[model samples]
Target chain A: MEQILANGLYLGAQYALIALGLTLIFSLMNVLNFAHGQMYVFGGFVTYTVVAQLGLPFIVGLIASAVVLAVMGALIEKFLFRPVIRKSKRDESTMLLAAGIAFFLDAVILLLFGEKQRGVPKVVNGVFNWDMRLIMPYDRILIAALAVALIVGFILFMQYSRTGRAMRALAQDRVAAQLMGVDVDRYSMIGFALGAMLAGLVGGLLVTITGINLGMGGPTSVKAFLMIMIGGAGVISGAIAGGFILGMMESVGLTLLAAYGDVTYLVIFVTLMIFLAIRPQGLMGKPWG
Target chain B: MTDQTQTTPIVKGSAMSMNRVLGVGAFLLGVFVLVPVIINLTGRWDFYYTLTSVALLSVAAAGVWLTFYIGRINIGQGAYALTGGYVSAVLMTQYGVSFWLTLPLAGIFCALVSVLIGLPILRLRGVYFAMVTLVLTEVARLTALALPITNGAKGITSIPLPGELSILGLTIIPDFATLENPKLAFYLMAALLMVLTYLVLWRIVNSRLGHLCRSLQQNEELSASIGVNTAMLRVLSYAISSFFGGLAGAIFVAISQSIYPSSFVVQDSVNFMLYCFLGGLGYVFGPMLGTLLLYFGWDLLSVAKEYQLLIYSGALIALMLVLPNGILSLLDKKGGNK
Candidate 1:
């Protein structure tokens, strides 16, 4: 039970970070950002190239990933999403554009990073054994601590920062914020960049543990969608709660249903479908918001 | 300047006319008679396979288009396609059922399953519905992997070709295996299905049901207040949409004589919506034209080799940006001028 709890907590921290970026962009632009998983994978590759190929320190590699992804996200919003949303009559047109960008990124990632899985040298090396009841690597413990710190830092930034307040207003009501002198376009771009940066940070942090590959992009995006849906779409606290709930479910399901093979995800997906049917707005989200 | 009253007559008569009849006749002649003759002269027999696949893909895209018609972004058509393939494969190989018998059975099964799934999810807001449906293809894949009757990871293979399809005492279609060139036969079969699918779609769009669906698309709350059975319409369209997807999948399995969990993945589902978007979401035949253009365009880009996907995706993004309403919208503008 202690082992499962530890595993869930570690998984929850990372999963929450991934969900945070996606929900942020969704709230700001009402675009689902299908390329989010690709952005995450791109971040992992940036970190890999920096640390493994260039022989740079891991911290520098992590910063490089965040910077690269933020720029990409900003440019995509300005050039692709913003213009498309403005010109198109239908709102769903953005979904097509996002999916196209996802394909474009997947192709780009393949060409640049290749198809093989990549990992960096571990930052720390030692197994933490606690009374033989729970075992975890020291690297995992550090990554989890860093992830929790980042989440707390993000919440603080959103709560107190000037730019964060403007973004919150824009998300709450775009026209109202515009009327109140908020720069709608600029803030939207920033929100997208910030969301993407979070994805990159998580990718870079987890690269040492799970490694990264080209194929992980689609599944990662799907899992992130599931997280956001469970927590309530576009809600920060809900994302964190959904993340921990999913992490706990996964940990427990995997261990208990070990003899039954890979039925955990199937059950979880069905349950999510039923849960969404019962509560379309999610646990914390407003209807259609 | 023309008055509004004069334009109404033109708009009403536009649905049927001598010019429209001739245009459709030309299109039919071009597809059925001219293409095969050109392929024979060029000796590019493989073009048959490419066109057949396009025809089948467009059928599924038509289903996606229907959901879009009802104001839903359906990224779950692949699930129905996969389910249909598995149903047909399992029945033909395991239950000793004939291929012809399993085709409608697959479609009906998919329709039934979709109704069960769509009832609850369809009630959500469009955005929430989109998000929920997005995971459905993955869920279908996982279910396929876990289910024992699906033959697990190996998938069902080596299924027999579609046998002779007949009605009463007449043999309408001969067994595919006995044909001299099954490629041509498969192409004809798929083309026939495509034409039939679009005709039905065109009919539906012109009917009273289609008007209610359009109202739902425009404003669901207003439509519901005005006495529309909004829930039933949504679910009915969804069922019909999944039926088309299932039929397409069943035909696809017959063409390849195999079924696998990975056969219809999430990319294919997204591409179906892309087809509708590329052609023109408002038009009935949009998906057919979109599928033809995309499939051929991809084939043409094969010469790019390593940069093929990069170029293809880049072109797709550019095209969506340039033609936000779709390629057919350009035609609509020119047609409206008259």
Candidate 2:
């Protein structure tokens, strides 16, 4: 039971970061980036390379991953995404373009890193004993804490920062934002970069546990999308609620169901279908204007 | 969405008359019919498998194109294909059903299943539908793995080829077991199926229902407001798409001689969509052209060994950016739009 709780929260936190990034972009630009998970993997590998291979400090690696990935994300937005957007074919090729980019990233990673996963050393090695029975790794607790902190920091930024206000305005009304003299192009780049940066931060932090699996992109992307959907797309609080809910559900399902663990995805898939059928706008996502 | 504004002239049959189209189709049919013979004569019979696979894949892609026509992207056709493969396999192996009978039965079964699944999900537009379908193949694979009837992950194996075409042991058509190059027969069979699949699509596109479908693509709200049953149309298109997908899967099982949980993965589902896009989603024959080029393109890239996937990805991204309408759009300036 304790293991389930810990794992669930840990998974939820990781998913929270990824889902937040996805929702961030969706709210700002309405682009459902299919390649976000690939960037996550790429970011994790960047941290692994910087810290484990180059013998750099973990903090330095995290910062470096964030910066490098933010740059890559911006470049991708400018070249791949912006062109498709400029053509006014946003919905058509967004999925395919992101998927193509994801595939490209997968191939690049496969060629450069090979198929084997490279494990990263724990960020901190300690144990937290609780209630004389439940015990958890301090590394896990740290990872989870860092995830929470980043998320809280992000919420505050969105609440207080000028860019955050601009993004929220854009999300609410694009034409209005443009009329208000907000630079949609520049903010889109920032939104995308910020989204990628969050994915990178989570990827870098979770390297202690996830290590680095090249094939993680597909499943990761799906789960993140699921979180956003469940939380209601276009809402920050919705993303958080959805991510934690999914995390707990997955944990409880794995623990209680045991032999029926795989059924969890089937359940998720069916639930999403039902939810979309009955509530197309989602709980928090107002129909896009 | 880009194609939504542009006219679908080719599929509407605005440019080519029936005679020219049929004449071109007949010439292509003759070429497919002769491919196996040429391979046999030269003794390079292995290409028949590649040809057959491409043909079957085109059938699946055509199904995806139908959904694309209705303004919905289907990334879960693999589920129907995989289900179709299993249905035919089970019917043939356990129930002693005729291989010929299972093919259309599989299509019907998949159509029914798709209708059941689509009725609810079709209400959601755009990426939501695509997202739901994207996970469907995975869900299907998992279901196949968990179900006792599917025989777990080991999967059903040794599926017999379509029973011999014979009368009182006097063979009019040779069985796969006895043929020197059974792939030739498979190629011809697949080609015939492809021809029939497109013929049905052709008939549909020329019909009133096809015009309604095109209208939905161009403007869903306008059509819906005009009393067009957009929801029912979307479901119908999806059902037909899955029917084709299932048919292709059934044929694939006959050729592979087995069905597994991993028989058709999510990647194959994505590839089906890509084929439609790469072919010119606007054209009915686009997937046929796209599938041929991509199937061969993959083989040609095998020489690169490890870098094959990298090059493939590059090609896909570049292809989308440079020729978003698909390579077939390059055939004419007025937008292949078929």
Candidate 3:
């Protein structure tokens, strides 16, 4: 039980970061950025290339990943999403554009990073073992700590910073924010960049422990979607809660249903579908928000 | 929402005008008669496989398009397709049922399954519905992997070809095994199904049900206030949409003689939506044209080798930017106003 708790906490920290980025994008643009996972994978590859290939420091690699992804996110918003959203009558049309960008990023990732699974060398070299009941690597602990720190920082930024406040206002009501003199286009880009940076930060942090691969992009996006759905779409606090809940469920499910093999995910997915059916608004989100 | 001014004009006019009949007849003649003759002259038998695939894919895309008609961004059509394939495969391989019998059975099963799934999620807002449907393909894949009857990861394989159809000892259709060229046989079967699927789709879009569905698309609340059964309409369209997906999948399995969990993945589902968007969501035949263009475009890009996907995606993005209303929108006199 202690081990499960520890594992869940670790997973929750990382999962929350991913969900945060996705929910952030959804709230800001009202576009479910399908390429968010590809961005995460791209971040992982950036970190891998920096720390492992170029022999850069782990901190440098992480920062580089965030910076690169922020730029990419900003450019995509300005060029692809912004114009498409402005011109297209159907709001759902962005989904096609998002899917296209996902494919583009995926192809780019494959060509640049290749299909091999890659991991950076561990920054710390110790295993934290407690009474033979719980075991985790020190790198995992460090990554989890960093993830938590980033989440807190993000929350604080959203609460206190000018740009963050403008973004929050934009998410709350786009027209109202515009009427309030918020530069909708500029802030939308910034929010997208910040969201993508969160994905990158989480990806870079977790690469040392879990490794990264080309195929992980789609599954990662789906997992993030599950987390957000569990909590509530576009609800920041809901994303955090959903992440921890999903992490706990996964940890417990995987451990208990080990003998059953792959049934854990199937059960989780079906449960999510049922849960959405029961409460379309989710745990924290307003109905149709 | 402000951009909703550019409404897709409710398809109006004589249902069967002389010009429309002639145009459709000529198109059918080209598909059924000219294409096979051209393939024979060119001696490119592989074109049959490619065209058959396009036909099958467009059938599934038609279902996706129907959901779009009702204002839902469906990304789960692949789940129905996969389920349909498995249903047909399992019945044919394990129960010793004829493939001919499994086709409609597969579609009916998917329609039933979709009603159950759509009942709840269809009430959610568009994006919520879209997100929920997005996970469904993966869920279907996992279910396929976990279920014992599906043969797990190995999948059901080497299923026999579709047998003859007969009534009262009078043969209506000969067995596929007895055909001289199964490729040609599959192509014709797929084309026939495609034609039938579109006919039904056209009929639905022109019918009163389709009009009510369009109202749901425009404003569900207003429609509901005006005495439309919004929930029933949504679920009904979704069921019909999924039925088409199932039909496509059943035929696909028959052609391949196999069914695998990985046969229809999330990418294929996304591509189904892409086909709708590419062709023009406003038109009934949009998905068909979109599937043909995208499929042939991808085949043409095979020479690009490693850069094929990059080019394809780039082109897709550029095209979406240029023609947000889709390729058919280009034909509109006012350009997207229709």
Candidate 4:
């Protein structure tokens, strides 16, 4: 029972962290960024190279992965999305572009890394005992703690920082924000970079739990896409809430159902999506004023 | 100015183009039938199977392209294909139903399922609908895995070849077992089916129904205000789309002689959408061209081995960047693309 809680919280935290990136890009730019998962996988590759191959400290690898992917995200926004965005409908073309980028990155990774899974040894090994009743791994605790820290930090940054506020303003109203001199284009880049960075952070963290591979991007994108939809996309808080809820459910599923866990998780995920899609207001989302 | 306005009109093509389009469509489809036969004459039978698979795949992609015409992004067409494959497999293997008969039955089954689900799910607009569809193929895969009738993870294997197809007393297509290169028979069947399906699709798109669907793409609110029954139109297009997907999958199962959960996966769903997009969603026949190019393109890229995907995806991105409207757009008349 205690193990379930620990694992569940850890999973939820990771889901929240990864989903934060997806939701950020969607809300700010209205670009689905299907390649967001590729960015996450890329971050994992970078961290694996730094820590596993280069024998660097885990902290150094993590920071380096975040910075590198953040820049790549910005570049993608400027080059990939900007050119044809106005030519076609934003929803359709962005999806196609993102899928193209995703396939490209996946192939590149497949060429570079092959299909084998490579693990990054845990940063902090050994277990932590609390009152001799509850034992947990230190790295899992650290991961959970880091996820919370980052989510809070991101929220505060969005609330207080000038650029963050501009992002929020854009989400709230595009034309109004543009009228007030928030360079829509610049803010979009920041949003993509920030979103991609958060996904990279989770990717780096994921190396400790699961080995990274070339094909992780497609499934990761699907799961994250489902998470946002269940939480009623178009809002950050909803993404976080959906993440934790799904995280707990996934932990329970894996613990109880084992091999059939994925089916159960998706079944529950789809049910909630259908329900919320019908409602659209969702549990925590605004009533669509 | 008056001639231009009268010629183009506002909504669909002029009535006079119908016979011309029919003539061109018949000619192109005739080429599909002859091209493989011509290629096979050189002792290269593999191209026959490859092009056959292309036709089958484009049939499904055409369904997705239709949904796109109605301004809906459908990412789950694979679900219907998977379902349709299973439906054919079950009927033929379990009930002793003829394989040819299973084609329309599977299509009708899938079409009904789409309408049953489309009523509520179609209410959601844009990405929400797309995101939900993203789960659909996965859900179908899981159900196939868990369902006893689907025979679990092993999937239904060794599905018998379709019996000889006949009309009245005439045997048009011989049984699959009797053919020396069954791939040849499959190619002919797929090519003929592709031609017939394209005719139906062309008529639908060029007809009043096609105009209504295009109106939804341009402005749903305006179309609805004009009493177009936009919701009903969406549901209708969705049904037609899934029907084609089902027919294609049914044909696919007959060719492969087996059905597995993994056979039609989420990735295939993505590929289906890409085929339509890469073909030129604006044109009714874009999916056909797109599927052909993408199929052969991937085969050509196999030379690169490990670097194939990298080069292929890079090319895909470059193509989209250069021709957002797709390769067919290059041939479009500059000022009047339509």
Maximum-lDDT candidate: 3
Judging by DockQ against the true structure, name the best candidate. Answer: 3
Candidate 1 recovers a fraction of native contacts equal to 0.65
**Model 2 C-alpha lDDT per residue in residues A165-216, reported as the tens digit of each score:** 8888888888999999999999889989999999888889878776988988
Candidate 1: give the clashing pairs.
none
Candidates in descending DockQ order: 3, 1, 4, 2
Q: Per-residue lDDT for A74 in model 1?
A: 94
Q: What is the C-alpha lDDT profile of model 3 across A1-289, one tens digit per residue?
A: 8999999999999999999999999999998989989999999999999999999899999999999999999999999999999888788889889899999999999999999999999999999999899999899999999999999999999999998899999999999999999999999999999999998988899898899999999989888988888999899999999998999999999999899987998889888888888898889987865
Per-residue lDDT of model 4, residues B1-338, tens digit only: 10122234344465646755686877776656568658867887778778899999999998998898888889999999999999999999999999988999999999999998788777776777787777888888888888889998899999998889898989988888988878877887898788888888877876889889888988898999999999899999999999999999999999899999998998889889989888877777789999998888998788998888888888888888888877666656454744
Mind giving the per-residue lDDT tens digits that candidate 4 earns over A1-289? Answer: 7877777788889898888899899888777878878889989998898999999999998999899889999998888887867665335877778898998888877776678888888888899998877788888898899989999999999999999999999988889999999999999899999999998988898888787987789889988887787676768898898788778887777777776534666567667656765686455555541
In model 1, the runs with Cα more than 4 Å from the true position are B1-16, B335-338
| TM-score: model 1 vs. ground truth | 0.97
Tell how far residue B193 is off in model 3, in angstroms. Answer: 0.8
As a whole number from 0 to 100, the lDDT of residue A88 in candidate 2 is: 32
Docking class of 4: medium
Error of 4 at A281 (Å): 5.1
What lDDT does candidate 1 reach at residue B247? 95
Expressed as tens digits, the lDDT of each residue in A153-237 for candidate 1 is 9999999999999999998999999999999999999999999999999889989889999999998898888998998888889
The residue-by-residue lDDT of candidate 3 on B187-287, one tens digit each, is 99999999999999988987789889899899999999999999999999999999999999999999999989999998888899999999989888889
